[model samples]
Target: MADITGIPPQSIDPDQALWPNAGTIRSSNQTNAAGQAGNAEKPTANNKDGIYVKDRLEDKDVKPEKIIFSNKLEASTYLKLQQLATYGGENIQEILEAALTAYFVGKEEASRPLPPKVLAVLRKKYPFL
Candidate 1:
């Protein structure tokens, strides 16, 4: 992947496009015109910027899953969501997935308990201190 294939479809100055104009890569805390400091540096497989793409951090291919949204968000809200995603260096899909997952996990943890047999086994394996 490191091997550059000629040039990209559009000319990209890595320093200008992704990095600061400084001679070397600047700190993640450095601010850009978009005002995104890229605070979180959990690297992804693609590793575009330092900010974490919660879903991509696992180094797994993002399976293309299609689902239709009701598109209920107001236009301004949608734009803000896009801007936040861009500024935070997150994939919008991953952000949504993380939100959905957290919601479901929270509900599941509260509503669903493991079978008594499993709990017993765990208790036996490691006694409560």
Candidate 2:
């Protein structure tokens, strides 16, 4: 015959009788009281002197500045120019202007098409052209 409690036979020990007050059990009311106490100890509002508050203010102050340059190579060239200027005792602004001018001149030269001979070879290889 099966036990009316619906518990498995192996789980129940016939040698030891079950007591009503044996193991530790917590009620729902006790858990709610503990949760309320923990919540009360937690901070309700943000602290003005906190790291997050300082970072927010710093972020607002950081504005992107306008940078006028022809290309990435021009910027890189400008850095090299600055280094040369340091060694030659010239000003950074002067070096930057010279680099900018050289970049523009080189760009203009590169924009022009190849000569007729080079164009003929390219055309032979690429039918679409």
Q: Pick the candidate with the highest TM-score.
A: 1
Which stretch of 10 consecutive residues in model 1 shows the poorest summed lDDT?
A: 21-30
Point to the candidate with the largest lDDT: 1
Tens digits of lDDT, candidate 1, 1-129:
335676546667875676443222122333442343344345454467654464342433323343324447789977876766556665566667787778887475757777899878866755551
**Could you estimate the TM-score for every candidate?**
0.30, 0.21
Across residues 11-109, which tens digit of lDDT does each residue of candidate 2 receive? Answer: 665433443222212223555534443232323334756444323434232233412234455777767765565445454445566766788885867
Q: Model 1, 62: alpha-carbon shift in Å?
A: 7.6
- Off-target runs (Cα >4 Å) in candidate 1 are 1-70, 108-129
Q: Which ten residues in a row have the lowest lDDT in candidate 2?
A: 19-28
